[model samples]
Target: MKESSLFRYAVVGLLFTMLAFSCDSEGVINPTPTPTPTPANERFLVVGDSGTILVSDDSGATFQAVTSGTTATLRGAAADADGHCVAVGAGGTVLYSADSGDTWHAGSCATTNTIDRVICYGSGKFVAVGEATGPDPYGIFRSTDGGQNWDRYAVTVTLRGIGARSDSQFVAVGNVSSLNDSALYLTYTTGASWTLYSAPSANFPAGAGWLYDAVGTSGGYFVAVGSDGSLYSADGGTWSAGGAVIGKLTAASWCASSSRLVAVGYGSGGGVSKGRIYYASSLGTTWTEVNPGTIKFLFDVADDGNGGLVAVGAAGEVLYSPPPADVHDAGSLWYDGVSGVANELYGVCHVP
Candidate 1:
């Protein structure tokens, strides 16, 4: 080959060699660290008569469309340890999510019954309770496999809520069709057998007319909530009136770890024209009011323990209450000294 051509070839070869060595030595320039995806944060969901759902990530600070699934009014939802969740509502509807809540496995209630609320009993079991007019006395259903299938456990009266201290022990709240009396209901055998309570009194305004949700405390102390400001006890079977929960008191949820308690519904009765909820860190003192909207009627509330809370309501409003700047819910250690404003968040639960 010519001298100049040969020189050019040598230069090209040298350049190629230099390039190869450079790539390996200094760690391949800006090689991305396999971008560790920002794990999905806990989310809050809202469901109401609109048959649509709203979701938030920043402790109800803001939200966007988490789902447009199911055109039925979603009334209730329950979350499991495996991040699986289910929501039910009008026209006999149910929607399940295995990925925190990004997507869903929608299903028909099969009874056209309105599932008012649902709860997870650990493991893969779930219980949903509500009222129906069709065949038999419709009340509650047991889904052992995270709502894949449902078996009617107890059907009578209007069972609004179901909670379990354990898989075998639980309480379902609602009133029976007898006289002019309303009561709180309990079941020790996972809804197989049930007993009723007086709920402190039978008078309206102060008495629990129709119970909604039940929450179990650390020391066996349980609180059940209902419309028209209702809070009752399930000591053994008979519900005793705990007291008139502040606000409308539509739903009651407890965070045992932080000792946080939340109840949402509406503003004061009588003179109260709209709906609001009462929140407390101790549940033993004064309850604070959260401003969601002018006609905000909170239907449910839940804690995700990610220093946050989610509440849902009648209006299309959803709010979040982060772990108080003090992480205080209802205790001293947890007392972060910050007041958790009960914004109208729909539902909130821990992801991990």
Candidate 2:
């Protein structure tokens, strides 16, 4: 109980308390903070006939089949900002997936005809285009509630392709009637109305020109591909000839991150159905063909958003081409016809 001893004891106790507080109070050790993990890059969904779907996590390097609850042949597909996707196919069949591309459920727009194309335009907006088997239904439909309900447009033509610039503006490409001529449809009022756009003579050759697919670029430019060649619309109307691609181009998509546009389809060369991809640095400009070295028929091409591209085509072939414009060096085959399970892939879209 001496004064000096009491002072020493009090100082020791204070030092022990300070040490305890510095190392997390209540004897709880603080863990080293871990930085948040970077998410997986480049998700994609490739859809094809017989309601088949293949999903990829690393761009398009690999794929696995996901269950789609229908036997209807799917043609076109698109994904939203939140990883939701909608795919359309024959007999007005629509499939929607909430968890990226894992599982899909059926959705409809009340038509027995085929739904050729579907696009997700962010903010819970979706658009689908196809022909009507009968006269009672329109060719285009729109959904605002994440594809839960659809509102049909008034136009009466078979729509093959569709794209949206924003939540309200959209462009569709297809046949005006059962005729073999090309047609372009535009809507600024979402889906309330549409107008068929006529093109001036860029003088397409005297063949039955048909537009198969259309896409809206970043700067208000729209590019469409078809059996004859490629077409361009600077202001979403008043189309002019972009140029004639060598083969039948079915689908086109623009990559704003790399300033490239890729169009895909099949062509008969060397007496075989070969896949063709045309690449351009800018829209409405001349494009160069880059052979991915595949004889499979390619129907759709999409940008992977990481300076690369993924294309899907006949017999469920999913092709991945990396940057620096070397697509032939990177060929990862997703499907082959050896198993008797090959489905013709008609559409592909990047999952954000």
Candidate 3:
């Protein structure tokens, strides 16, 4: 070969060798690191009229429907730490979801009465309460077989709400079917046997007091909310007033992360009342109200397991509060977004 050509080839070869050495043997160069995706922060199960059940993997930003296997109106839902959920509603309707509410199947309790609320606290153990239109109507129920079947309790009052501190202990509250009668309050210490509790006549006047929901707190306390106000119990039996006169509180939840309690309901204004929300750091203490600016008839509220909250109400309206702190400001949380269903959303629950 000519000297000039050979010199050029030698130079090209030297440049190629330098470039090859600069990179790894595998030929990868300055590769950008792939980012790890964030898993879903929270999962939520929401049930409403017409047997509607929706799941929101992204907090409450969006929702997808799950087959509920019934056309009855679903009123309340409950979940354990593992995300096993049970929902109840009209006509004694009971639905169970083993996979964090992703899918559901119908279950029977051999009653034609309406089940207003349900709570699952232990493995295959569930408690529900509601009213009935037929014989032996108003009372509570117990299910040891994971909602596959249930056994009705002896309490004859219209039980609106129920909660369990453990598998063996539970508290339920409600009102008499007759408006003139007193509220129906009771507690279960061990099993089938339930002891009745009478609220202070001064605090819960007859015909005016109606307890709707009760929840077990991580702090080892139970708080039952109602139209007259809130009641707190160290053990689920003896109760005292929580002194919250906000309005007709329908539901309350205990947020263990923040050690706070949140309650939701509607104001008792004359006609077409607006929704209301209250928060308390301690039971039997004064509760502060949260103003959402816009009015909605909120029926249920739950802790999001992220220090925030989720509430559902009329017209499938959902409200979500952010995590790690205060959301009292009108716009601090989000609302007014539609859930695609026109039916009223009666209950909401969050699964970690």
**TM-score quality measure for candidate 2:** 0.79
Residues 203-292, model 2: lDDT tens digits: 333453788888777677777778888776667776666766656888887777666677888776545557777777456468666555
lDDT for model 3 comes to 0.72
Tell me which of candidates 1 and 3 scores higher on lDDT: 3
lDDT of each: 0.58, 0.71, 0.72
Candidate 1 structure lDDT: 0.58
Clashes of each: 24, 0, 0
lDDT for 108 (candidate 1): 42
167-227: candidate 3 lDDT, tens digit per residue: 7778777876666333544555444767766544544433347789887776678778887
Runs of candidate 3 exceeding 4 Å displacement: 1-40, 132-134, 180-185, 188-191, 199-208, 268-272, 325-338
Q: What CA RMSD would you report for each candidate?
A: 18.7, 17.7, 16.4
| lDDT by residue (tens digit), candidate 1, 1-352 | 9999999999999986766443212122212122222323565665555555555565455556665466676777777778777777766677777765667777545567778777887755677887745574566777766676677644557666766666777777766546333454567766556665543443222445666677775566566666544443436454444544445466766766567667777655445456555555433234554444346565777777544566665445554555544555421111011112233334434433
The TM-scores, one per candidate, come to 0.72, 0.79, 0.79
Superior candidate under TM-score, 1 versus 2: 2
